[model samples]
Target: MAGFLELIDNTLGTHFHTPVYDPQTGRKKILRVIELASKQHNEGTTRAPNRSWAAGNNEGISFSPKIDGKPVLIGGKETNFVHKSRFQDFLKGLKAAVEKGDLDKEIKAALDGDAAPRASTSSSSGTRSGRNPLSNVRSSIGRSLGNGKSLEEAEATARANPKFDAAHIDQVVAEAKANAK
Candidate 1:
């Protein structure tokens, strides 16, 4: 049985690990999915920042493990493999490292650098002047009509302005028409 297991080990690598769970919440330290992928067409500087490689019966497979969509960089470079047969062994080693918290610092840095929440579109206050742009359009149109400019002139000025987009123009025009009546 030992020899049989060794033969299997030679064919495919091994990683013996169980993830650590928090005592209070029953949550794994790494909440995201763990994935290993093969590299493909990484054509650019550093050749595709997110490339990985694995092949069937093909040597020189690359391995970059991702946790929550972030690659765990080692020495500032992705991990690759020349002996393709060692794929399973490498995978097991990666899992063991995760279990041992050997990659926590690297993982934390990756997550921190990303700033996931701020990158999301749900934030209404960024890039633009801290206020909803539509409100600015509303005020502009109101001021134009208030300043003795005829509706036609005000509408023409709004349409001619390049700073506003078509949708905003349309919205403000509709509101102006409504308020004029």
Candidate 2:
């Protein structure tokens, strides 16, 4: 059920709308809100942006059933209007649809073909392994100061790296001076 929900989320975003076209008139018509579980609509946790399923409110896990820009009838009443206790039933229905391969093939293909977003970095190899670049530079500056290389040479080494800004260089220099004692 979780896997099916994840696949659906990756294909069609949590907050997205689809445009309904008039087949007889052959023109684009109403914009229908498909799946809406917005954070702004529900009160959230202090740490999290929205109410999680495990936290009692199923707003995060609930997915609405819409047809012709309106809620579909599940048990004589609109599915969205139903009480929150029936959220498990809604998830089961969604899982069944996924198992029957009711999702659009084109959307699945597009999602599968796209690459994941890359992390931003100055180094050619992008690895943020919890090491501060400034600290490394500072250590190198301290080493240089210990090796009898003048303060100017240590500053030059710090300046050569594009990652080290003016403030970073100053911090490194101050650390190097402190380490000399």
Candidate 3:
């Protein structure tokens, strides 16, 4: 529904100005907006996020209709609405907000029971965590090999090789040193 989509955009545009914890609040807000939009548009349907869709994905929000065996109308056309990726972009923006700590004030406000509106602004930064030790080793190997393969590929290759285990390599090196002595 165009109204639902517009509500999503407006809510995101507003709520995204301030940060919220868990990203689920943003999701819930989006759902509430969709519900209001459905009411405004005279549709007898409810939209809520699908949890099963988030099993392995890093980001994105998937919403399903509450009413069963009914087609959702968009632009005066009836259609089978399976799932909608509603808050994917909004989640990305919220992630950026979290990383910049812009969300701390907003989260505190929410926890403090204040329902003030949010304000939009630019200029934010984020920091990424360091790589794992094994992944770092894999990256080093890949770099030395002069190939464009990723660290995961190098790690997989090393893991599949029979003689590539740490203890095995140490044993082999010790045996060679003893033989030379």
Candidate 4:
């Protein structure tokens, strides 16, 4: 299972950081939906440097877990997956749903990294910034993904990009996948 998780993370660059088995009890963590999402893609970076607004604020809503062997939960509220075997499959389904555009507004927003509340801009604002918000992030992920270079070459190129991190590359890919559809 650990090898499988590592393979997924390496190939797709995703952060499925949930501890499926406890260290002491050897059982999955008692996780709520929000806790799950936060672990996968928690908020830290912001759209603007000075602003507090960030993306993925409503990320919790995307966690659609099947409990008690049914794809249903009451009140659209919190729940858990008690059965250990179900989590891996559930994550695969969630990824498929995002890839297929079967997502709620909040999840869509979180996926796009644009769900954070925005401050009002001046009505007279006319100047266009030359920078694309995702250029650096895209480049970083690209470098980590090999960028047409051999594995060894890609590893070397990855070091040149300061924004690159293994888990972060995963999150970026996940966000890109969400936005692609």
Instruction: Give per-model TM-scores.
Output: 0.34, 0.28, 0.20, 0.20
lDDT of 4 by residue, 43-110 (tens): 43223222211233333223333322222232343233323334346555654554444444334333
How good is model 2 by TM-score?
A: 0.28
Local distance difference test, each candidate: 0.53, 0.45, 0.39, 0.39
Q: How far in Å is the alpha carbon of 117 misplaced in model 4?
A: 16
Which residue pairs of candidate 1 clash? 13-89, 38-52, 38-53, 39-52, 39-53
lDDT per residue as tens, model 3, 1-181: 5677555545456666675456455334434434443443333232323321221144332332211222222222222222233344443444455455554444444444442322322112111123333443444454534466544454455556543455443444344346548
C-alpha RMSD values across all candidates: 19.9, 20.9, 20.8, 21.4
- lDDT string for model 2 (44-74, tens) is 3223322222322533333333333333333
Residue ranges of candidate 3 with Cα displaced over 4 Å: 1-86, 117-181
Superposed by TM-score, candidate 3 places the C-alpha of residue 139 at a distance from the truth, in angstroms, of: 58
Top-TM-score candidate index: 1
By TM-score, highest first, what's the ranking?
1, 2, 4, 3
The stretch of ten residues in a row with the least summed lDDT in candidate 4 is: 22-31
Ranked by lDDT from best down, the candidates are 1, 2, 4, 3
Q: State candidate 3's TM-score.
A: 0.20
Where model 1 places Cα greater than 4 Å from the true spot, the runs are: 1-52, 56-58, 114-181
